[model samples]
Target: MKRLCTLVAAVLVSTSLTLRAQAEETINYITAGGIYLENIQKAYLDPVGKQLGIKWSVETNDVDTPVRVQVQSGAVTTDLVEFGASTCALGGAEGLYEKLDYSVIDNSELAPGTFSDYYVGSTIYSMVIAWNPKKVPNPPQNWADFWNVEKFPGTRSLYRNAFYVLEAALLADGVPKDKLYPLDLDRAFASLAKIKPHIKAWWASGAESQQLVREGGIDMIGMFNARAQSVISDGGSLAYTFNEGLIDFGCWSIVKGTPKKDLVMKVLAEFVKKEHQADMTLLSNYGAANTKIEETGKIPADLAPLLPTSAENYPKQIVTSAEWWAKHGAEAKERFDQFLAE
Candidate 1:
């Protein structure tokens, strides 16, 4: 009887192991549409998956509709997500993101408070003014200067996105930087109206903005600093100013109903480590969310001007008001669409 019982226990243990393996067939990670995915796959997914023994698959999209639909439909396909400031707020407001229990994760190595109850910032990026130095030897220095198209004549490419561009327009029209939130809609639209035809195209994504300047197709642009950094690194004749740049960050969140929430939080904590964050920044040309990442003191001097975290640049920039923007985003988008239609 003892031998028979031992044989049955062994069979049960094998069956349990098989079931667990089958349950965690893969970890689904969703990311924003950008070149940053190249760095994320290299710096985080490949090595981290090898360490954790989980299969990793990354999917990318431009907006949050898929995530929203999945959550509302009670069919959560994405286990982990990395998204921008606006999307993070949208998820939080819509109750689509998981309430992270950080007890299983180690965030001691990250900057203080980088981890939130529902989300963790993964990287820092900024929407800043960029110019082709060759084309405009005396480039604009501030939001006021960028609006002076008659003095600095050339085709400009502005951000097509509603939030950043609206805030920027308000600033250009004399809305104090600190008072930009709860925007002045009429003046903002008027400011954009004044510059509409001067804009050759409104860039819809990072790649589009980067290509605009890299190919010397446009003279001035409001572009993400990370994309501009790549251009400068490649010896492309482009430069950017941190002044009046709208500071924004990307965050990682777990889907509210994912079975792999624990594993997703593990990846989030590991990715925020100073060393990992630094390597990711190096690869993607985007700033690490970890404030503790030590600069290796090897940043390119020309590109330094575009980096928001650089000491000289950080002081002059402004952090975007995520809450206010999120609250007003839908209405602002409608207004912008109407303005563009005119």
Candidate 2:
């Protein structure tokens, strides 16, 4: 009888250990580092980890190289990742991400056209025209005005990326908002050439743009709205306009062959909850992709108009097409680089 009792006790102990191990499974996620990742960790990952009794390990990489390496090796270590819209579309087309199981992940709360079968929009940001009001008392209201050096005269800074630069050029050339896509590359480049001589710098990062504006290195710039807001918050003598702003967003996707797809989906759904989405905006000053935040008044009234998706600002901006860019961007980039050289 004593031997039989001991055997039963050992079996119970083994079962308990197995269940605990399963419950404590850890997920690895990758994202762009800096304040964006910090905010996501604080508002989404940490809370979800506590509530769901799961563990998440995060790594930072600005590009998709790490994910590509893992997928090619047939040994994906990162279960999920966040990347720009262009990268998301390209990766999706290349089958680098899993086909999201929408049945398990509810995206009803997200903004219209924000999520796809392979990814969900994580945050929204914009590129707008920023200027030092002291230098140019009369600010340019739209892209067309921005091109009129005679009126808003000063050295300018523009993003190094071909995508935003081309779109801005098209708009400045009087391309209607509805007609901007399937972009007129020849006309866009022609327009860019007219202003190229006036441009003082081609900024490669948000920090560079901000620094140039803050130090009076450039009188006007094409820059991110969040960076401009930082200048305003610091009481700098800079101002920006949303008219003709270029709306862009980042997305979260599951790695193609992750064995933990179901678990990752659950975690993703949690991360995009209305409350957590609101928290993300508050922490990072970027717009939430969840439309419910607007209705729920989670976004403060003062900050609403500043968001790229806000009703007042939405119509004034051009929403970029990730799919179109994914298809034609390479050629456009090559042409743009050659144009710059000449």
Candidate 3:
């Protein structure tokens, strides 16, 4: 009888694992549209679907509003939804997100707190001058070109942050890439003044930037490279150049109370593989969350040049200096505020 019971227990565990894979064969996911959705389809959804013998339903939007609304309705249509960290925390606090099972999703290689009980960050991105080549057939190649509105006529947008804005202005005024560490506040502001009237919006968030591009709100805008590519892939009239792009990171998360948690969690687990993360970089220029990606040589030699952290792209772009900003950020921000008011 003891031997019979042990055999039964083993059978049950095996059955449970099978159920997780087979239960809810179609997992619904929602995220920002464009190349992001396309890449996920190639790197995660399509491949994982094949492996698990399942299908996926994906929805796209510019923000988390639909995901939030769906969860609030207590009948989440989406099994997995992605967001930046702060909004993910909000969803968790409001009970819209549940504590993720670390046992199911590997967190070993991930940055600490990359995923809390609610969210996970899987990629790094860069800010770039995204423009519609059709609108301005010959768009800006560098910051100086961007400021030459007469030469490349177009409505423009920029980030609300003084960091990128200041650096760009100094560059527009002919400051060398290496010499941009201690930003020239006086010269930077003056450069901005020349283009201030043509500035259609000072986008405050990633979502707003997407909205601008998706809706054709500007002829050219400073935006995330991934998002610009995403919208362009989704049929928005935009393309990006790397001249002085800013680099940063963001997070992703799952919705709470989705009935198919087991299957969705499995999908999340598949995303943890360094190989899959590397595949994501190949699909989108956004850098991978996997630290092992570089060491593993997952990104190809030719492809590496196109990515943000690559040897070729790094020298030409602008990365914010934390040490420089730590001291001068306050005064710079104050001046930017005053300039905006003026």
Question: TM-scores of the models, in the given order?
Answer: 0.88, 0.91, 0.60
Compare candidates 1 and 3 on lDDT and give the better one.
Answer: 1
lDDT of 2 by residue, 93-159 (tens): 9999999887887788888878998889888988999899888988999989889999888889899
Q: After superposition, how far is residue 128 of candidate 1 from its true place, in Å?
A: 1.4
**Per-residue alpha-carbon lDDT of model 3 for 1-342, expressed as tens digits?**
999999999999999999986764877777767657778788877788888777878787545778778877876777787754445665666677767888998888875545677776667677788887778799898888889999989889998878678888888899988898778889999999998999988998677898987774688888888777668668877888887886545556677778778777777888877887888888786876666676667677876755776667756676655445546766888999999999
lDDT of 2: 0.87
Ranking by lDDT: 2, 1, 3
What are the per-residue Cα lDDT tens digits for candidate 1 across 1-342?
A: 999999999999999999988765588988864567878887788878877777987899757788888998999989988888677877877798988766766566554434566778778788888899888998988777888887887779898878788888888888987888788888888898877878899888788888888774899999888888788888998888888888888888888899888777787767777767767776776776777666544345654455577678877887787777768888989888888888
lDDT of 3 at 159: 89
- Superposed Cα deviation of residue 52, candidate 3 (Å): 2.5
Overlapping backbone residue pairs in candidate 2 total 0
Residue-level lDDT for 156 in candidate 1: 91
